[model samples]
Target: MKPVSELLKKRAAAVRSVAPESTVFDALHLLAEYDVGALVVMQDGKLQGIFSERDYTRKIALQGRDSRHTTVREVMTPSVLVVRPDSDVRECMSLMSQRKIRHLPVVDGDRVTGMISIRDLMDDIIADDEMTIAQLQSYIYG
Candidate 1:
């Protein structure tokens, strides 16, 4: 089975992120621009928090807070669950499943390495299974 590092290596080299001081509104804009569900919050090249659509909905919208006035530090998940670049894909999947989170920030120490979504995992798993089935069929038929 391929590792999470392999998936990250196969995809783009880095994660999408914003500064912790950035407003929730700005973070929302960045998420829309990147077409992603979450953005890793970084400050001084160190991971700070993670902001997601759920945060905006649950924290800002539910509280009737002004997104433009609130910073990511105010609305983001401060205790973010992060995965290492060397972690296995199964480990990542388990984390996401157990936490009920769709997005996970991949970190290499203090640096943001990449971001992953549940969709990415499902796609990779499906592709791998298909490849395995095809290989088995070819061997049996040949």
Candidate 2:
């Protein structure tokens, strides 16, 4: 099984983040601009939590809270599920499925490295399957 570090190398290494004290509205704008479903909540160069569109909808809009006044920390998921660089991709998939979460932060020690989504894993799996099928076809025809 491939490790998350390999997957991280295949894509951009930058992990977008916002300060915990930032307003939900600001975080929303960052999400829109990045076209991502979630953003890592950072405070003092540390991973504080995770803020996603779901948090905004469920915690802010549903609660009738003002996005401009509400802090990202207030609506963010405080207890985030994180993965390590050496973690297997399959394990990450299982965790996401069991937890019903869409995103995970890749951490190496205390530093946040990258972020991966369900879509990323699914795409990688599909690609690997395709490669295997192609190799099988080549061997059969040889």
lDDT of model 2 at position 136 = 98
Q: Give the TM-score of candidate 1.
A: 0.93
Candidate with the greatest TM-score versus the true structure: 2
Clash count, one per candidate: 0, 0
RMSD, every candidate, angstroms: 1.3, 0.9
State the C-alpha lDDT per candidate. 0.88, 0.95
Q: Model 2 lDDT vs. the true structure?
A: 0.95
List, residue by residue over 38-123, the lDDT tens digit for candidate 1.
99888888888889999999999999999999999988999989888787787788889998999888878777789989999888
Give the poorly placed runs of model 1, Cα more than 4 Å off.
none
Give the best candidate by lDDT. 2
- Which clashing pairs does model 2 show? none
Q: After superposition, how far is residue 65 of candidate 1 from its true place, in Å?
A: 1.5
What tens digits encode model 2's per-residue C-alpha lDDT throughout 1-142? 9998999999877899999999999999999999999999998889999999999999999999999999998889999999999999889999999999999999999999999999999998889999999999999997
Per-residue lDDT value at 124 in model 1? 88
TM-score of each: 0.93, 0.97
